[model samples]
Each structure stands twice: as C-alpha cells, then as structure tokens.
Target: MTASFEGLSTSAALELLSVGELTPTGRLTEASNATLYCTVAAPGGAEAGCVYKPVAGERPLWDFPEGTLAGRELSAFAVSDALGWDVVPPTVHRDGPFGEGMVQLWIDGDTGVDLVDLARDTRHAGLRRMAVLDAVINNSDRKVGHLLPTPSGHLYGCDHGVSFAEDYKLRTVLWQWQGEPLTGEALEGLAQLEERLRDPDSPVAAELRRHLTGPEGYAVLRRVRLLLHHRVHPYPSPDWPAVPWPPV
Candidate 1:
C-alpha cells in the first residue's frame, strides 16, 4: 500500500509515483499530464487505487488567472457536486518534488468512447443523455477523450476546465445531438436549473453570477432554457468559438 499524501515526503511522493510503487498494478499512460496508474490496494484502503493529477509547471495553452490549475480543478469539482453531477473528487493536494499535485479517486473504466465512435454506435442512449447535460452546463471542451465508459455500461465525463464559461462557450463533440427533442425529465432539470440561477441565495448561482455580468448570466440561463424548451440550437461553427480556448 502507498502512504497517504500527507505523510509522503517530497522525495517519497516523486519516488513512489515515478517508480509506480503507489499504484503498483497498472501501467501509466504516456499522454497523461500527471502520472496515471492503478493502485493495488482495494477500493477502501488508505492506499487504495486512485489517479494522481499533479499540477504541471509547463504553461498550458489555456491557463486560469484567478487561481492555480489545481485550484480551478478543485473549484470545478465543487460546482459539479453542487449541481448534483458525478465528478472526480479531490483526495489530497500536496507539494511533491515535481511541484503541486492532487490525488483523486480512481475511476476504473475503459477509456471513454470517441465522439465519432459514439455517433456511429446506434445503441448509445447514455451518450445521448450526456449530450443533454453537456449542453445544459455549456461544457466547451467535451472532446472525444473525456468520456469514459465502464464495464457496467455507465458513461462518465472528465476534464471540465472549460465549462461554465463565465462567458458562453458551449463547444463540444456532443453537437450531433443538437436540435434533438428534450424529454420531460430534461425539461424539468432545466426548469430547476433556471430557478436556481434566478435565486440569488444559491451559492452556485451566485458564484456563476459573480463571474458573469447580469446580462451574461441571464443569457446563459435563457440559452439553456431555450435549448431545453426548443430542443436544440444551431450547431456551433469554427468561425465563432462558442467558448474561449482556456476558460479560466
């Protein structure tokens, strides 16, 4: 079992992660920003399997100005939690030899299906459902790589740094579902979301409003409501970036 992040020395954190001693069983992916591997420990163990997303010192194409990358990730997790969506929860944040990084619960599953594959697969109802959620939240970076599919047939999304926009960036691969009819359940969710946005007392709504101007906030709310009420909007084009490249 691996030691907790709190107890790990900077050298130990770097060593364990680099040597694959922490997540002993799985192989790390080459494309991963922070090292990603599966832990050998059982799900509930202190050293249980989890994914580590250490903050990268390299400047990214899009960066957040209000906070550190880790802070933005933590904030997004909080927002998703408040909105009742499942998201990767932060387990620990610590300084390691490499720099600042976070440990999060590992989501054991297959690499998410590519958007092209999902579109080709006729039996993807869950993907369809996710499209609605993506649209509602204005998730701008729903790239093919972000949606994981578990063995049990559930789809989970990740990498939402570009969502909520503070502006209105709704770019995503789920655009195929554009103009599809909204079900009663979807409509109800939107109605609830609208009410929440209208309520100044709600923390999420307040936070969103704080980042966006009154008109911008209303535009977002109205746009979402319109999508729910009318089923779809025009598919976004490359000419106009619906969302900023890096929505900090």
Candidate 2:
C-alpha cells in the first residue's frame, strides 16, 4: 500500500495535487461518480497518489440541483484546512485528462478496522472532530464507508461533493457525539474556522466564494457560528434524514 501522504504539509500536498502530472493508475469502480485513482508527480520532485473526479462526469441528483460537485470537494477541503482538522485531504480544482475536476491526495485506509464498529466508537477523537467538521460544512452525506482511517491514526474522509449547501442538511453516521459538550480541540478548530470565514478576502472565504453561491458561502459562516454558540455537538436536523442511506 502507498503511504497515506500524511507527512507532507498541507501546502506541499496542495502543490502536488495542483501542478503534478496526473496519470490514472486505475478507476475506483465502486464510486458513484467518475473517480479515477491517479499518481501525481511534481516537477523534478515529489510524487504521490491522488483521486481525480471530473465535474462533467457528475450526474444530476434530485436534492442537490447545484452543479459543480468538483468545486464542492475543493470547498470542503478549504474549510478543513482552515480548521486544521485534517478531516479532508489536500484537494484542488484543476484541469485533468477528462477536463476540469477535483484532485485529492490519496489516503491508504486501514481496512482491518470494521467501519460499522468504527462508526459507533465515539471514544475516537478523530471521529469526534469529523462530527464537528460535518456540522461546519453542512455535509449532507457522511456515510460510514466514506471514513478513511490510516494506520498512523489520522482519519480522513472523501465524497464531499454534496457539502456546503445553503440549507441545513447534515446526514451522517457520526451521531454518537450528539448533545455532548465540545472538546477543547473541537472548540479551537471551530474558533479558527469562524475567524477565518468572517473575513471576505481571507483565503478560506475566497475559495468558498469561488466554488459556492453567495448564500452558500454565508451559510458556512452561519454554521460555524451556530456551533460556537451551542458549544456542544449538533443534533440531527429534524427536517432531513438523520443518516445517509446504505449507512455503511
């Protein structure tokens, strides 16, 4: 298995994903969208595995009428980067062989840990941070299958194409922390997110605006603020389904 690429700084990983020559190693057939497993080599330098998802390859979903799933992927990464949560991997919106798309650093997930068991394992700090992250991103799909647990104990997630919607729609299998008091780390992350997003010209806000609608961009700030105000894990929204279909 390839290294999870966790050692690289976020900037270095972003650079590789942005300018590295992408060569498709294989296709992720299990993915709903066109997901290509690729190797990206930087100019005369570093190389790593990544996943490429082209925007044109996305099919219309009834609830998520907004186009540009690739952009949303980058947008999700922006928030995660700002929070320093590492919930999402280093991702970028760039042109690929299939056209403009999202490229994310590949993570070699440790498959020995059963996801169903992991989902209910609230004692894990990474899972808790993810719950707070899903709340901030307004993630509408956070299935157990999306979790990527590395052997080094870093947890990453994928398939964030349906995130950062203007409306309240957070579906996930991470409800174990519901109504629990926010941990110090989670509070710090949320504080950082709120501070970064409040500035319109901040890199995080700018990236969000580039990908999401004006209202959606504002909604991101609102979500962060709500989390800070509550100072507790969010409960499932009554208006939407509490969890994702095919949960695992």
Candidate 3:
C-alpha cells in the first residue's frame, strides 16, 4: 500500500503536483468519473501518490457543462484554502496521464475512522467545518465517503466536482448542526472567504473566477454573507434533496 504523505504543506504539495511527471498506477474503478491513481515524480526524485481525474474521462452530466468537472475540483480547493479550514486536500489542475485534469495529493488516511459516525456527531469540530464549507459552495453531494480521517486525526474531503453551482443544491449528510448557531471558528472562516471574494485583486478570487462562472462565484460570496447575517446554520433546502443518494 502507498504510505501516507508526510511533512508536506499544502503549497509544497501543489507545487509538486503542478510540475511533477505523472505516471498512471491504476484506475479507481468504483468512481463514476474516470478516476486514476498516479505516481508523481519530482526532478530531484521526490515522489508522491495522487488521484487524477482527467477531463477526457469525465462522464457527461446534463446539469454541468462538458469538460468542467476538473475545474470545479480546483475551485473547491481554492475556496477551502481561502477559508483556512484545510478541509479539502491540496489539489491542482494540470496535464495528466490522460490529459489536462485535476490532480490531488492522495490522502492516505487511517482506515479505521468511521466517517459516518463522525458526520452524525454534532460536536465533531472537523465535520462542523466541512458542513459550513458545503453550505458556502452549495455542494450537491457531500457523501459520507468523501470525508477521510488521518491517523493524526486531521480531516480531509475529496471528490468535489459537483460543488458550486449557481443555484441552491446543497445535498449532504452533515445536518448534525442544523438549527444551531455557527461556532466562532465557523464564523471566522466565513469572514475570511467573504473578504477574499470581495477583493478583485486577490489571487484566490482570480483562480476561482477562472474556473467558476461569475454568478457561481457571486453565489458563494452571497452564501457567506447570508451565513454571517443569519448567525445560524441555514436550513436544508426544501426544493432539493437534503441528502445525496447512496449517502455513504
């Protein structure tokens, strides 16, 4: 088994992913999208395993534009970084084994953590952050399987291609904090996201604007503002499914 990546910050991982030579190791057969496991080799012989989702391999969805799923993955990471929550793993969009696609540092988390149980627990700090993130991006699918717990207990989420629609479509299994007030950390994270999005010169905004439509970016900022104004967790949409199918 590939070992957990160690001693690398998010920036370092992104740099390696952007410039590394990607070698396909295997395909993740369970995913509906064309997902592959790749080995990234740096010029100096440093190596890491990563998940690659090439645009060419994306299954067409009627709702999302063709060839945009990879970009959404990058955008999701951008928002996560801007929030300083570090919920999503380090991800980048670049040329891959199949073609240009999304490449993310593989999180080799501990196999024993029950993410479903964590999502169910109202007081779990990590899940609270993730829930807030889902609300900001209007995540359409926050399946329990997307949440991974590291051996050191840090939480990471993956497969964010279905997020950030211009419309309200937040479907998730993280309703444990429903009707509760936003914690201080959650409020602070929303503030950071709002500030970054409002600055046209911000690198985070620039990167996300490149990937998401103008309305989509605006929707994210609007959601943050609404959350800050409400001071409570937003209620699940009555018009859309509250939870993803095959939730786990």
Candidate 4:
C-alpha cells in the first residue's frame, strides 16, 4: 500500500504534493543523493506516498551547479506538462520538513516488465516520446532503471535532476532511434513548444525561467529548434558518453 499511487488524479496529485503536509517515512538509499520516501496528507485528509529530494541533500556534481537539482526536477515536470507528453509524474517544489525540495507522486510500476528489452525497442511510442524529451531537455542521465512502466501500459521516467544543461549532454539508454525521423506527434509538440518559448511571457516559458538560468532556459528553446530543424532523433554525441553508466 505504501508504494501505490492509484486513484491520485493529476489535479489532486499536484495540489496534494504542493500544499500537503510532508512527512518522511523512509529513504531510498540506493540513490546517489538523499532521496526520501514520504507520505503527504492534504488539508482535506487525502494521503499518498511521494518522493522528496531536498536541495540540501543533493551531492555536488562537477558539471552541474550545486543545490540546483531540485529546481531542475521541477523544471522537467513543467516542460513535460507543456508538451502534454505525460512522461513525468506530478512534481512540485515547496518547503518540506527538511527545507525546500521537490515532491513527486510515487509511481508503483509493474515489475514484471523488463527494462532492458524495452530500452532497445525504439519503435515503442512511449519510449520514443521519452527519447525526444531527453533530447529537448539535454538530459544527462537516462538509465534503463529510470523507466517506470505501469500496469495500465503508461511509461514514465524520473530522476531528471541532471537535465536541461546549457550544453548538449544527452546521455541515455534509449538510443535505438538515432538518426531516425521523429514521429508526427513529436514534430507537432515541438512546434508548439517553439511557439511558447518564443513568447517570453508564456506560462511555460515563465515556469522554466523560474527554475533555469537565462542561458539554460534559452538552451531548451535552442534544442527544440534543432529537433524541429533536423526532424530526426538525435545521434549520440561523440565527445560525451552516449549512454549513462550502469545503464540499468
């Protein structure tokens, strides 16, 4: 029961995670940074399990600015919401018991699914959407284990704290579609995204600017433009490692 996020509607999930009382129930110790498993109860008594990653607990990365990981996670959710891709679960940034952090609805995925098999199948529509998302955000980490497949056949990805860097640092396990044309859905989404980015006053652009530095926010627009121009899935960068370490 602790793992299930069933029945948490998108609106309810966002409201609960944003304004609910967060209590740390446990910790996800395998994570490189401190990742707490928490239960958040809304004012109306609705409760659900969630993951909390405090900015204070983030480990400093040589390539990333320290204490910005939590913001990046929230930024990813904002972009996912804008693209209507449903690739990221409900996430919010607020002051938690430990300080300011990100709280995301816990996803109890179907464990029977095999990530290795899924990663190699570029034809899978959900995975392709995720790949395109990574390219747009310049995701630096996309391990197979990050894939969350639900019993309902919805696939979500997490751990986007390292994404949206100004530099093109896309490292992921889903690379089977390299140099292939993007799906029609992706092209349409990218066009809308470009339009939103072009308008500095757009809500999506404002949300991204709230979390990302000016350069980083501009980089997201640039990446989206590149995707539309090439109209193909990105090829792995020769300078950077194509895939994340310990892929699974």
Report lDDT (Cα) of residue 205, candidate 4: 91
Q: Go through the candidates in order and give each one's C-alpha lDDT.
A: 0.52, 0.88, 0.86, 0.89
lDDT of 2 by residue, 29-133 (tens): 988899999999988789999999988889888867765888989898888888887889889988999999999988889978888899899799889888888
- Per-candidate TM-score against the hidden true structure: 0.61, 0.95, 0.96, 0.95
Runs in model 1 deviating more than 4 A are 1-47, 54-103, 111-116, 119-123, 200-203, 206-223, 241-248
> Candidate 4's residue-wise lDDT over 1-248, tens digit each?
01224776687789899988999999999999989999999888899989999988988999987338988998898888878888999999899988998899998888999888988985688899999999988999999999999998888999999998888899999888899998899999999889988998987898888899889999999999999999999999899999889888
Cα-based lDDT at residue 223, candidate 1: 65
Candidate 1 vs candidate 4, lDDT winner = 4
Estimate, for each residue in 27-86, the C-alpha lDDT of model 1 and write its tens digit: 456432545555524233334355655567424535234334444444344344444444
Clashing pairs for model 4 are none
Comparing 3 and 4 on lDDT, the stronger one: 4
* Residue 75, candidate 1: C-alpha displacement in angstroms: 4.9
In angstroms, the error of model 2 at 179 is 1.0
| Candidate 2 Cα misplacement greater than 4 A, ranges | 1-7
